[model samples]
Target: MTTYSRRAPRTLLLALSAAAVASTLSAVPAATAATAVPTLTWEPCASTGGPTDQECAELPVPLDYRYPGGRQLTLAVSRLRSDRPEARRGTLLVIAGGPGSSGVQRLTQKAAALRKEMKGAYDIVSLDPRGVGGSTTASCGLDEGDRDLVTLRSWPAPDGGIADNLARSRRVADACARNGGAVLRSFTTANEVRDIDRFRQALGEEKLSAWGISYGTYVGAVYAQKFPRHTDRWVLDSSGDPDPSRVARGWLANMSAGADSRFPDFAAWAADPAREDAGLRLARRPEDVRAVVLGLAAELDRRPKASDRPGRPLTGNRLRQALQGALYSDSAFPQVARLIQQAQDPAATPVLTPDIAGALSDQVAAVTMGVVCNDVRWPAAPASSYARAVAADRVRYPLTAGMPVNVTPCAFWKGAPVEKPTRITGRGPSNILMVQSLRDPSTPYFGALRMREALGDRARLVTVEHGGHGVYLGNGNACGDREVTRFLTTGVRPGRDTYCAD
Candidate 1:
């Protein structure tokens, strides 16, 4: 994930300038903090079907480090104690994907799988970042329609005009300024790293092990950089380019290339003879799948197919959304192809999953926007500048069209960044291990190579010659999974970059 450095001066002309000014005044460098241990109280985890061994706790962190004794927000945390105390090495924190994904929920979902693999080697734990899940949250107070995922993702107009994008960007940024409070401002990557250190202190662990995915990889890298001594085994999965200059902005822009690299895997699967047996085939030939999809998208662009939902239809945007969703996992390939097959036939109707259309609540959107916008400043000159980039992007990356490079709320965000973005270098410990899919849709291979370069000899990368995101355990690539597990459990890493062929 890319983010702008919060180091600029706040000026009325630019929203990010104010944010930068605020960050500068309130900034407390993570490494310079006084070494103070935090007291933690554990209670039974709260959820509809929470496990018997699961427990929850709240860690109080200052909203503004400058005013350490001022207002505090609670970070919702959960843990699954190590089953084998004799074998327990330390706490393993699961840093979740998506600036918006809930870490607590991820811990709950992956606890069993982790337990089976780690075999009581460490306590599995995670926390919902501030402004997510059960944690203290801030809202942009966006209207219901604008809060929808489709709108937030910046899907182009039916004719491919980006007028709506520019308007929405300004409107959303304004809402965040008026409604989002200090809690939202404090939700930067640097702050998350600081909070992780606080959690480490609270847990009484001399060193913390972690498995961070997607956006989490950048966070984990920052933690390892900021608190090198406190790190145990660190695993960064499906990482975006950790370019400090552009930060999350670069990650978003790179999606154009990432989608292009990973789309062929989807195309091949959609056209395979095996898909005919599943009744999910979109094309008789692999090469035809792209044209078929582009044609269908154009048709949808002209006239959307009605879905079961009253007002919602399967538009070009929805198709793009489904495609983006499907690209995340190989298991989702058939589902997207099926949607295409259904949309292609006049008699058949497409089904929309609740998980697909739901926009995060106002709080979730706020944090997602806050982290990306806060970490980096996006170009806000004019809609035409984005339009030019979008038009070029659409020609090169038809799978994603221009959504990834389009203007977002961050373009009109309220102030410059408040702190310098963490530049990941080889200066940290050599304990970090990265695993990536060569053709990952979200975090592409070329960008991962840059991360490999940035880490220098401080880290080693295991590249899985496969498609999709989250290589280890997500895709059925046993080689990558086993290698990562061995490294985390036994502290043995491949001496150099290695590839796992499918």
Candidate 2:
């Protein structure tokens, strides 16, 4: 889930007055008072073999909303205008997953599919949040070892010991405090929401429709809560619980259940007769696949296997982390199965997932840690509390190996949340629709139901009887995709909660 890269100005005259007033407001510093809706000078984006029509621009937003006039950070924004302008009704924002994902890249990746589906009904757009690709960035100056996917995820030792985890957590926290300045501190869900509003103003549109996936769902939900009047038709895919008290902490803890729910799908796939010919089948029965995977992990725990990467062996934790990554989609099952097969052979060298093989870039690590650590304060309880949690979690959910409940840098984070997390409520417009898989490895269906509950009467949920982290255009579920497309194109939602069979 933390793969990091997994991934306005309507009434011109009145708008001018609003900008003038905002500049002079006592809350804004005098040195940097400027129009809130700066005109965007869009130009053709540098060719990256993506959609030829895609255009890019830079939007300057305050690094700190509390001091809007003090400093500025530029957000990288991109758009693919409607081919049929006559059919266009509004702008649709595409929100990418991951607190560190590049919205600009996501736009490029999805532009063609979205364009084909929407059929020029709207000009699709997205913006890289601060500290992402093509945007202003900050670093925590972390050691390469600390930034590795396995280490950043806080996976425990072979015997389930967390002593190493505790030390790393404290060290990461101290490094962030010393090296990550206000820029890192500026990364939070609240700040991101504010940035969206600023982007809306710059777009010169009265409202925006959106398709927010994964963690983007949380960002979209907060935006709807803060600026209900500015939303037209909002779609949240692969949503998680919107419990403000827990926030990212709750999402992480819920992964244990999510992985359990989703693993069966992978197990079934691995056991299928079709995989036998490819030498990918792991077992004779669906139930047997679980034992095969678990047994392999335990064996690795006892004696790690050398991998394709020199000096970077495949340990139990690395395998577990790889499984977690693969569970996000059915398409990845073969890779995980192959890794499993290779691990079982003494002479075979397993190929590591790129993420598990090396360290994350400092900017990527900074934003991922910044948002989760800054959004809410993790419990600063004694290490024993975390040890107990990890121990219990391991027994309860072996697939995750207690990593979900393990202590992280958040517990020792130097910065406190600048503002309270936004509580998503039903008070907003009933223009929101959520699409979720029944068994999401990153965001379980049970957790998504919590988000459905929090939104109350204002939202409609289209549950897909499928297994994966994303729904809607993802997973190839015609039923689910139709429901979302109908809502976006026609603004017509199912009168009650609905289900889509796989």
Candidate 3:
């Protein structure tokens, strides 16, 4: 499905400094702090619409770890046992990205490929984090109108305004405050890290290896730091900076640079000869592609064209948002180009894909916004701050416009964090491996480098001179996949950081 998790924090724990994160590891509350988590009972999970070899189980943990004897959260976990028993040494946890992504589904989709690659050195396993997938669920009961991707992402309005976004921030914050309960509040990265350890305990493994992508990389880092001795080899793919000060807000704002870094690849592809026949070509030359896209966006802003949906025409910001998503992969370029070509026709109606065309479910919208807002305390600076930031960002990075810096629901969130966020550090074992795309549209190369710097001597990074959001197995970049697999199976890392040519 090419499922990408748009990845999130709080107060027992509020701001995580490197030293705090290091010291907290020694105090990670035991599995039986007050109530012991239940033993998992694995059963064939084929009926859940996943891979056949997958076994599923429910691992119960405290809904609020601080109150161990309170209500419980049943996380849905799955695993594909190693086929080569003699080579099996431990469990390889697949930490799927997204504050709302499903880890079981991720393991299902990649189980066959992962098993084939490492030749069964470990049992591949994953769990849907709290408030995600089959785990305990919660919703803000948001209106359908607020679930649109462009709106959800806080894309600035025409004229580079964020008034609408600010209002939306207030509206979403109100909805969550009114409806999102403890379950929603519990959707923080630190809790997910705690849950991973509970899963490890259920499996009876001494040390677990891990592969976390995007937001999952943050989860993996926290898990490694909080439970250093419990970790084996760990690989972080397409990571963003684990800046405890900003957390999700920092990652969201980083999209400006990330989109800028990746748009050229799409522009080059859009200008290809093959696109001419499809009437999807944007320009005769790559340089002109930007102007064409920007011009089209402005035109749409001036006069929104009729779309397939009644009374809901295609807006400029929506088109821009679609373009940003399309730039994530080369395969999606055609869809964005087709939309642009259709919009160019005054009489033609543009058809929106499911991802952009309609509103997501209330639960989806709530969780997506909830996790990020709950991760850390967003600045309550005056409206002028966001307005200025959006205006400046639009000028600096036209591809993303001002959406990256625009106000989000976090700005008006009512719930204060229960704990501080965890800071990634070089204090743990030097067993972490990071793989990054040189031209990633989402996480971007530069942010990943910042993460590399933060990890310092604790990690080795594999740089892929490629354009995409994910690496290892999915990108067909054999170099990235090889390095990650080697580290996972053989525990052998490059002596120093290295790069892999496209």
lDDT of 2 by residue, 147-210 (tens): 9889989999978899999999999999999999999999988878878877777777667899
Residues 347-399 of candidate 3 have per-residue lDDT tens digits of 78898755678887777777778788888999988999999998899899988
Q: What range of 10 consecutive residues in model 1 has the weakest lDDT sum?
A: 1-10
Q: Write the per-residue lDDT of candidate 1 for residues 1-502, one digit (tens) a residue.
A: 1111212232321332123223434455534333334456889875666557899889887786665556878999999988887787777999998898899999887777788889878888999998889889999999877787778889788666899888998999999999897778888998888777767766756578899999999999988887777688999999888999888888888887887888889889888888788798888888898899889989999999998676788888888888887887899887788888889989998887554555568988899899999987777768788998888888888888898988899989998888889888999789889999989888888888888788888889999989999877789899999988998888899988898988
Best candidate, TM-score: 2
lDDT (CA) for every model shown?
0.82, 0.87, 0.82
lDDT of 2 at 336: 89
lDDT of predicted model 2: 0.87
Q: Which residue pairs overlap in candidate 2's backbone? A: 8-204, 8-205, 9-204
Q: Which candidate is the best by lDDT?
A: 2
TM-score of each candidate?
Answer: 0.92, 0.95, 0.92
- In TM-score terms, candidate 1 sits at 0.92
